[model samples]
Target: MDGNRVATLVGFAATLVVLAGLVWVVGIDDTLAALTTADPVALAAVAGIALCWLVSWGLALWTVLRALGSPVSPHIAILVFVAAVFSNNVTPFGQAGGEPLSALLISTAADTEYETGLAAIASVDTVHFLPSVGYAIVGFTFVAAGAVQLTRNLAFAAAAVAVLALGIPVAAVLGWQHRYRIEAAVIRGFTPVVTTVARVVPRWSPPSAASIEARIERFFAAIDRIATDRRTVIQTFGLSAFGWACLAASLWTSLYAVGAPVPAEVVLLVVPVGSIASVVPLPGGSGAIETVLVTLLVSTAPVSAPVATSAVLIHRVGSYLLPTLVGGGVATALGVDHAASPET
Candidate 1:
């Protein structure tokens, strides 16, 4: 096999090993016991929370697509969203895998170029990032309100600082069209290591300077199209924020079901922190997500080691594994090729 294929197989094997370690660490029996002993009413409540999460995500995607002038029906958009979610889970590039799947699905449905669909998808991603800042803002507010505690560890503090630093560009892009003018200035802020790696395998196409400028113009024009309707913009942001809140609630409910007594706000903080840690381009966030979640829970919450471990495992099973299985089945039934899909 080719080197790339061999590397992919190695990565997949590593992912499996990580997942296996998680299962062992969490204790399969204890996890099963937690599930079996969970209160029926609590289980029902968790189910309700999951339903709300699905609806909120669908609404967020629908709002962004509509804002981008590709007015898909709500039902279709929800299906596409679910399929995208599934695609992201099975792919190796973390969340980046889902964007192209979303683009392809929408393009096929709308009978348009993949680029137009991608523009819409990119717009959705831009809108999605805005409300994450809202989460950080809300999380920090809770910390200040004594609803959650901030960690003193230098690493945690550094992560919080990094998250804030990353948010700057996202905020600038969402808030101002002229933010591109500052691209060079912002690019200069990267350290030598980051700058060197960026040059090594740049994510964007290496176009001529003129072509790059034109693409930026196109991106800005697309953003303008979505930004023109103030009401739509507000609604899109609201939906994205609501979706994130529901996701936090889902995590909290999963923990509660697994016998952990974490507060909702603590879940909010932990979820975002774990998410930020798992930003690496690994499939399902692999070991990184589990490590972050378990570590944060041990430090921040009142739960014991076994309980905390079980809770994180259950959360991953519900949020990642289950969705991936369902989404993959749906994609297969729709005649989508896993090997050829952009998400793969």
Candidate 2:
């Protein structure tokens, strides 16, 4: 294997070791005891919730592929997506590793270029991020309104701010597409910075003002095309919302399975916070996600320590394990040489 691949594997192994240590330190036996005591009906409910999440994610991927003007079969797309999930989960870089695997798999399966596959991936990610921001906005508003006591915990408030901060670029891109004049003003405001960066790069060639304007116009036009198509827009946003909701529900169901009666919204908030923490690029978010999730669950919900650990473990099994295994199997069966063909 190449150096990077070796490094990735090493990092992934290290992450697994850390997770093993965490489970041991936290008393895995106690966590298992909580799981053993969980109601059978609640366990079934958690399984159903996890199934819903997988279906929603598959649907979201299907919509994005369709939007890209590719007619790839949804079954194949979903299989590839699942495989990508596996790659991402076991790899060290979270979605970064997974996205490339996704792009490569889709490219190979559909006989497309890397760029085209990447474009499709990017489009889907845009759809996903928009709705996530919408949810975070709503969640933040609730917290701000004192409908939720999030502000009482500085860590939760900071997490909320971090999510909002991440959303700013996404909102800006959407705004630039929707409002041309405003976008132009913002771009103009950044011209000096852009120019300076261009100068610092030896091979950089700055675009002329007209060229820049043309590029911006094209970007806005593409966004308008996607945004104005009511069917496409609705399907994209609807699938994203459904996926995230199901993911949240899956966590809630896990807690229920552990006999913890936490509210669904609390689970929803915790899910996003954990996700945000996991963005730190560690394999499966390793220490970061577990720490944030345990902290949040302990502080925000009415649960014993064993229940909290079991709930997170169960949720991870559904969210990470099942999808990754499916994806990895699919990827193993597919030939890498198939990637060179153009998408039909």
Query: All candidates' TM-scores?
Result: 0.75, 0.75
lDDT by candidate, in order shown? 0.65, 0.69
| Candidate 1 weakest lDDT stretch, 10 residues | 184-193
Clashing pairs in 2: 82-327, 83-327, 86-324, 108-339, 111-341
Q: On a 0 to 1 TM-score scale, where does candidate 2 land against the true structure?
A: 0.75
Q: Which stretches of candidate 1 lie over 4 Å from their true place?
A: 1-10, 23-36, 140-158, 161-220, 333-344
- Kindly list the per-residue Cα lDDT of model 1 for residues 229-268, writing each as its tens digit: 7877788778777877877776777778767777665676
lDDT of 2: 0.69
lDDT of 1: 0.65
